[model samples]
Target: MKSNRYIMILFFIVTLLNSSCSDTFVDDIDLKFCGKCAHTGRWTVDSLDFNPCFSTQAECLDWAKKNGYSDRGCVLCN
Candidate 1:
């Protein structure tokens, strides 16, 4: 019946949408603008590590220090 075909089409569309909506991990991503920035760090659950190659390293460091900052990988400046 036509209803069966419509149901199949709807199911297919829903399947495609769900597949496209999957979340991605941040480490798998790269950028052209911030590739050279030092503030582009990623976080672990317990600590912050420096990512010197990222253009946003300074920003990331600040964010970590203010928000989630820990001394796990920090080098003392003082």
Candidate 2:
């Protein structure tokens, strides 16, 4: 019957809409963007220890000290 075809078309349209709607959803994401950088003399020994991209040099140093790093020097970079 024509009603059965109409129902099938509606179901197909609904399925397509549901599948396409998933693209607009976003999952949990943590992002940090600090316009400055920090550097210590430890980069020569270990490149991974040389973490930069901080809001300020002092903040970077504090993080280093808390993590038991001997970062006695700091310099901000762009």
Candidate 3:
């Protein structure tokens, strides 16, 4: 009887922990939530190469500049 009670308690604890670890709003957050944006691959100029995802126009622009891409090459839409 005592062993059965302990088993049930352990089962309940495991179930609760598993369920609590999950969230209803747990989802992939869209890094690009700002104005018009494009993948880093699109921002190519001269011989520079970029391969990354962005969540803001500024970040893309910054990377582009560092990689030799021009602001004109980037399009931002809000």
Candidate 4:
């Protein structure tokens, strides 16, 4: 029916609006990175330790290096 078609169109418009708004909002928020350290012989998740979140990847990497960890990297958190 014409009514059903109109309802579907309205729903589509609302969905588009919501998705666009949410995308912009998410882009405005800063992403956090955490430092991950592991042993040279161990690459498993269980062998890695996660450090506190940093505002930038460089900071996370620097923290790992300063802590005397041989294997270190940064990972996105949250």
Cα-based lDDT for every prediction: 0.47, 0.51, 0.52, 0.56
* Model 2 root mean square deviation, Cα atoms: 11.9
Model 3 lDDT per residue over 1-78, tens place: 999999999999999989887665466443332222243333222222334445555776787678656643444322
lDDT by residue (1-78, candidate 2, tens digit) is: 999999999999999988877643544342222222323222121124445544555665776677665544444442
Q: Which regions of candidate 2 fall more than 4 Å away from where they truly are?
A: 1-48
Q: lDDT for model 4, on a 0 to 1 scale? A: 0.56
| Candidate 3: regions farther than 4 A off | 23-78
**Candidate 1, which ten residues in sequence have the lowest lDDT sum?**
42-51
Give the Å shift of residue 38 in candidate 2.
Answer: 9.0
Better of 1 and 3 by lDDT: 3
Q: After superposition, how far is residue 57 of candidate 1 from its true place, in Å?
A: 20
lDDT of 1 by residue, 1-78 (tens): 999999999999999988876557445564333333324353222233333332234544665566545453332221
Judged by TM-score, which candidate is best?
Answer: 4
**Candidate 2: worst 10 consecutive residues by lDDT?**
38-47
What is the alpha-carbon RMSD of candidate 4 to the true structure?
A: 10.1
